[model samples]
Target: MHRFLLKLSSCSLRNSKFQRLILPSLNLFASGSPPPPSANPYSADSFRKSRAFSSKSRALGVRCISSEAGREAIEYDVVIIGAGPAGLSAAIRLKQLCQEKNTDLSVCVVEKGAEVGGHIVSGNVFEPLALDELLPHWRQEQAPIEVAASSDKFWFLTKDRAIPLPSPFDNKGNYVISLSQLVRWLGGKAEELGIEIYPGFSASEVLYDASDKVVGIATKEMGISKDGSKKETFQPGVDIKGRVTLFAEGCRGSLSEKIIKKYKLREEVNAQHQTYALGIKEVWEIDESKHNPGEVVHTLGWPLDPKTYGGSFLYHMNDRQVALGLVVALNYKNPFLNPYEEFQKLKHHPAIKSILEGGTVLQYGARTLNEGGFQV
Candidate 1:
């Protein structure tokens, strides 16, 4: 009876044009009770009938079927490998392509982090080109950006004093944002368009076809039970086959590195062609009297030798919290040059101290930034 049920399920799944294609040898199992009618596109009766038809077709040795229009429906159009900015952007682009072509192009996004904001830490300043183009009314909606920077300052600092300089670039159109908030918003937009986002699942391996074409991924399940024990299980990762796969795992992308090495991509590119910086940042609450709501300050030099490339920034974000941080290039020879120490010394600078007087640090963290820009 179990074998017969399995065969019926396979047949029904295969005959339903709305259902995605599955490999003939693949086994299907439900993790929990069947989903509700509203959750699935097909009704239970329709699914059962399709299953019966699929079983009959398979018995007759027919592996493929033609629609009334004599065209074969595709299972998926694209499968993005990561859920970071690049992967999300690619998914959005594929949706646009499907809309333009008036076809069903399924796009799936696979993220290893438990949440969209996991692994993302930064004093992120975005150009707003993509966001503005994609969502024109973002500003009017009062998005949770830290501040729309109106000024940029460069300070060469000593322990107690500093020299401030004007930024070489204009700050007219740029903005500083909470990276977590931005990612959450972007994820929401992707989901609204029917993009499948699988978070908290890490891709264990890449799937390739017999001809060596990249197909999908195998993701490991991750979660903890109510008693705090880890759950052990695995699921078929995002396998939207036939479409382009984008690798956007942020900095130090391990999987992306493997793929680059395997494909021997860009052999001419120097391994040290790029530079990395470790940035330590914190949010502090300042006395309302000392708070400057829209103020932004940047400091460079001193504590850091002139040869070393690094800087510090302090932005008075909304809600009386000040974002203070320092970034130090990793290429420096002195391993003793601690980023946290530099940040502390920077706070003591007379100019900075006056601004942050009596402020209390609330949150502290560190992250890596790609200083080599997009080309690297």
Candidate 2:
């Protein structure tokens, strides 16, 4: 049963600047708050630190201040990191729990982006398995998904020839979607349920109690200069304390990475060395006749050498829009070869070129893909 969200996170140790740097555009769009003493059930032993981070504290100097001036704490029922699919889903589920049990629980979700869904993006041929459970009325509400997958075409390209790949490229029960839009819609639903969502606030530090159990996280201070000097409008981060804290941050999340080490989240596993990849994508307004809404095309073997693993995807959506992207894995051996450069070269291939011969480019971007297959 579509349970990918049930098991996520735990990425590979090897990541790049594109994946690790703290930036809004870098995160995959994604969504909570706190409760009382009786709700606090976790113990310190639950989150044992590995001495990798001394004193059970993260080196991250980020701290949270109270809603008042005397360094008070803003308590909540739960705290969620990231506004991506997993995080948002968790928030919605918690609200559902509250509704079913007829209780009022404070849930807060902190996102580093300026707005909900602003940071999230994906190639996103979305399968609505989880969404069906989270928001069954999505169809009645008109979520921003319009193009259902109509047909799937796979091609293997040689120097100048285009060869069709075999079966398994199916288009049933999936839709090409703007993941950003989907998150926005989910954010709206969360707000409707009285969930507190604070965008533009990044959880820079994990907060631990006397026994070192993670209680919550600290939001980053604003108005700090690049040189570490406090700007005139300096504002210390607010410490959002909660009974439980969930980190659904995207791949290579610095905070998640730290928590994993502090608690040895992956110590027992003989896995997690990930193969990274760079994805470059663009949205175009293709010719009316060529725009077959729901038609999806994928290509392999031409833009990249056989030794290097990479491929391309093109999905036709509503309004004559076509979203296309290229992925180049990081294990490739050539230092001189650039993923973006290769993606640009891929567009010249006859197979891909014909589709965009007369199309007008509307938008495009690059993102890092951390394919650290999920762990149970």
Candidate 3:
């Protein structure tokens, strides 16, 4: 089943007919009962109108606003904002279509990060379904996707005891991968496809004409002072105009936030509510005796109250390395609770302590994740 899906997914990528592709999602439901009832369909429509009025009322807060002279404008067939998985994949597929159809098209991807993967962090164990569809021969091309999952360990922890539990999670064809490395690899592929990418250029405002229709974006000006004064070396931003502007700026992009409010895009039931999870992770080089490459461990129910939803993952990577992370609901109670401290508590459990005792910390980082569901 895994290989069959991979082959079919690769064919989809090769075709590059994005408009014809049906984006599939997998949703799971509990076994016992059907859902009670869904809210009225137009409930979203009414909610949106109220929210838009409220959003428009709060226009007093503004920071670092600027209208500098000498802005240079560039034209492209397509302007992609962001260099992450979605944006890069879009750029690749667009170029692929141009070549396949024998048409001339100019494409550029504007990235905010100093480099391709400079700001990317993710839980490394990944399903390569999309990767297979985007880069069919990624493995043959020496992409960084290696270290197939070998084992799974699920635990339910208490204050002092660690109990094993049966979990529904499956890892048959998944692999452990560094998202940063994966993104860098994708960036390389994009550059090879002749997609011009400008790093360190943050898209500040969505450019619009008198009609209020988005045409492109303007990059943020550089060399600004702390008091909003232009530095001696201030340079104006670029106005990259395109027929279509695609915003793939992950969860927390400024332009995305503005557009969401301006267009009232999240008025629907599922889209209106969002819950964030704060995950703090560290890579440690454990003793070789404790290293079990491709081993994934997940635990829940301890170091946190039942009301405070949380979990932890310990993925054993290659080279005696273990990536440990703890995720806690951003809406957690206990106002004084510290996210990093909670993760530290997660490590003190006997099950996790054993593997990390003699380990040396390699890297540490934290990121906020949008754990919100989407509805049609």
Candidate 4:
């Protein structure tokens, strides 16, 4: 009877919804999603009741106004630091939240770069899930994705040859993009939503009120480029206060670290993980005979013989250009393993050489990647 009952339970578990719920939990543990929150039914109830009460109070004609004037330092409803993906996403959410509450919540975004894309660097293959959900009709509006990747090639290489390895998700691959273009587009969308984005302004310090809550930010004066040269004039610090300050500075975020330490936000940065890699890249005008219009080739091994954690990519973008690059982790024991040499050696490979044979390198640059993969 017990065996029969077990079989019946197994059969019931085969239902689609049951599998959907169970599969994600199993995968979450397998993929390192955080454990469920501790039970706090009373606190949860109180939180919901408080929000409802706030909504009721808001409807009772409670107006939220800054205590100071426009010329004077005024506090915003929301202030976000760093204009990266994380910061922009937070701003969008805050806008939505304010809209739902029928409140005129002022938002200010502080960016340090000359423009939004100056500090951004990536060999980015983006899955447009977030973009599609956030900005519907993105494609119809001519989104900045360089190439919609339909194929992904993972090649394991020897000194002279390469062998393709079957990928786990060969059926679905991500789209490739020039990260700078995408960032500029995202900044435009944020601005369209009435989110005041101040580029070329560096956030130097955070301001806290008497209760030790983050109330505002102190921005450092920035040098703006004039007709042909940089101007060395100092602009006075502008203080923009807010109810909440969200720091979305990307990897090795200085301000984020400072705030975390000052507030003791979590016991010693719970996201204590590190993975660093130096990416050396060059854009080349592809030789017509060798160019496969929309191909993206990725390879591992070869140039990095002893190192098991390095890879190379050659992506064909629009405008007859190809982005060729190699990323190698700095954890290798060899103190003198040159990434530039590795990149040059990769170009000499028979498979890689034939493709880039007559191509002329247009630009050369390098940047660091935070490969800690969502630890924050």
Q: Rate the local accuracy (lDDT) of all candidates.
A: 0.58, 0.68, 0.68, 0.62
Per-residue lDDT tens digits of candidate 4, residues 17-59?
2221222222121213333444221121211222212443234
Better of 1 and 3 by TM-score: 3
Instruction: Point out the worst 10-residue segment of candidate 4 by lDDT.
Output: 1-10
For the record, the alpha-carbon RMSD of candidate 4 to the native fold, in angstroms, is 16.9
Alpha carbon deviation, residue 79, candidate 2 (Å): 0.6
61-97: candidate 1 lDDT, tens digit per residue: 2222222323221223466777666677667766766
TM-score of each: 0.72, 0.81, 0.80, 0.72
Task: Tell how far residue 179 is off in model 3, in angstroms.
Answer: 0.8
- Residue-by-residue lDDT tens digits, candidate 3, 222-295: 66899999877566676777788999897667898898788777873347577778877888889999988899
In model 1, the clashing pairs are 11-51, 11-55, 12-50, 12-51
Estimate candidate 4's alpha-carbon lDDT, on a 0 to 1 scale.
0.62
Q: In angstroms, give how far residue 199 of model 2 lies from its true place.
A: 1.2
Clashes of each: 4, 22, 0, 0
Predicted structure 2: lDDT: 0.68
List model 2 lDDT by residue over 1-376, tens digit each. 1232211111111223212122222322221012233321121110111111122122222223344434335666788898777787888888898899887666778788766766765667778777888788899987876788888888888867789877466659888877766777777677667565666677888888889999888777666899999877566666777888989887678899898889777766745666677778888888898889998788888779889988888888888888878888888898888888887887788777888989998777776778565554
- How far in Å is the alpha carbon of 12 misplaced in model 2? 31
